[model samples]
Each structure stands twice: as structure tokens, then as C-alpha cells.
Target: MARKKSPTLTEAELRLMEVLWQRGEATVAEVVEALPKRLALAYSTVLTTMRILEQKGYVRHTEEGRAYVYHPLIDRNQARRSAVQYVVSRFFNNSPELLMLNILENEAIDADELERLKAMIKNAQEDGSEQL
Candidate 1:
């Protein structure tokens, strides 16, 4: 077999992983079913992408009776972090502020969520300071 390039998944892969994460375990059909139309992706394309995900250690699968039960090998938060790192490094040039500002601009965070998000950010900053 050709060396399956690098296993590192891109943003697209991470999105697919989200469906698998939510479902706990899923098959190719299940994942395809979960995708939104704007994804503009074909079933075979998703299958190939997920197989690459398996090769890259982002996902795992077991033979369940006659079906392949696929699930994420990594934690959802960790996968999110990895994808964030990639985007920050590649597009945002490692500036989290840009990403945060983008999210704040495009997404709606209600007051309760805003407060919770603020608390999380403050806690993370404080924790970082403690390590120094």
C-alpha cells in the first residue's frame, strides 16, 4: 500500500470526527447521514476521509457482527485543540485573539454562555500564570 501520507486530520476531518464523537460510534453510512448539505461532500469522499482518519490514529473501528462500529480514538476536546492549533498556526499565524474575535463576530453567545465563557477564559489565564 502507498504510504498513507500523514495521518494528521484537517478541519474537514475534525468536523467528521465531531459526528462520530456525538454518535459515540458510527458507520460510514451513519456519518454520511449526519453531514449537512453545505458540506458538499460525497459519501465515498467521506468514507475515504474517515479511512484516512483511522490510519492517522484519530479514529478506531471494530468489527461489530457484520458492521464496522467506528469511533474517535482521541478525546473530543483534544481533537478540537489539535484542529485549533492547526488553524492558528496555518491561517491565524498562531493568534488566538483573531479566532476568538472571529467567533465573537459570527456566532451568537447568549449572556449566560458569555459569562460562562468569560469564566473559563479567566480560569485558564489564571491557571497559566500559576505554572510560571
Candidate 2:
């Protein structure tokens, strides 16, 4: 059976969205150009991906001359939050603490980064807001 389409951005779609987020708006050709050299996606591929993003409500396009200039409907932070929530739901079993613990155990976090994380945790504790 065919897999269902996910609302979350795929890797290719995220790459395209990153270009749109950075540039504010861009044509398919421009997005193709902005992508990493190693990605080597064709203009047609970028075009199709942008259309998919539009259908997913992540982007919108306007007719600019002969080309469609696509703009991100969602901001970078919104995308990040959604992606994190999806990860927390799927792999972390709806437990953000498990996600944090997994990262802390496996990842090599430096002292400065650890301090920053601690500060953020402290702030969160002070606020007493567990609504994630």
C-alpha cells in the first residue's frame, strides 16, 4: 500500500522552505540556485516541491511575470516548533523529557551550551508552564 502524505515537511521540502524563509520569496529557479551545490535538484523538482508546500499550507505563490514567486506562509520558528512537536510525539512517545534525556545522553554538548540549556530550564521552571 502507498504511504499516506504527511503534513510535516520532507527533507527536500524543508530545504526548499529554508531558501524561501531566508529570501522571503523566490521563484523555482531561484530556489534551485539557492540550494546547496551537493543537493543538485533540478528546476522542475524545485517547482513541484514548492507546489506541494503550497498545498500543505506552508507556502503561497504569486504570479510574477512568467514565473511564480513563492513565499513562506509559516515563519521559521513556527516550522521549528511543529517539527519538534512531531518528533516529540512520534519518537519520544509524547514525552519531551524523554527527548531531552535522550539528547543529553547521546549527544556531545559543550559546557557553554549546557549552561544555556540549564538557564532555559530554570526559566521554564520559574514560569511553571508545562504546556508543550
- Top candidate (TM-score): 2
Residue-level lDDT tens digits of model 1 in 1-132:
776464356777877988988888898888888988778788789888888888888888899888777888898888667767888877777999998988899999899999999999999999999999
Candidate 2, superposed: residue stretches over 4 Å from native:
129-132
Whole-structure CA lDDT of model 2: 0.91
Model 1 global lDDT (CA atoms, 0 to 1): 0.84
For each candidate in turn, the TM-score is 0.60, 0.87
Tell me the tens digit of each residue's lDDT in model 2 across 26-120: 99988988999997888888888888899899999999899899999999899889989999999999999999999999999999999999999
TM-score of 2: 0.87
- Compared with the true structure, all predictions reach lDDT values of 0.84, 0.91
Model 1 stretches astray by more than 4 angstroms:
1-8, 38-40, 87-132
Consecutive 10-residue window with the lowest summed lDDT within model 1: 1-10
Local error of candidate 1 at residue 69 (angstroms): 1.1
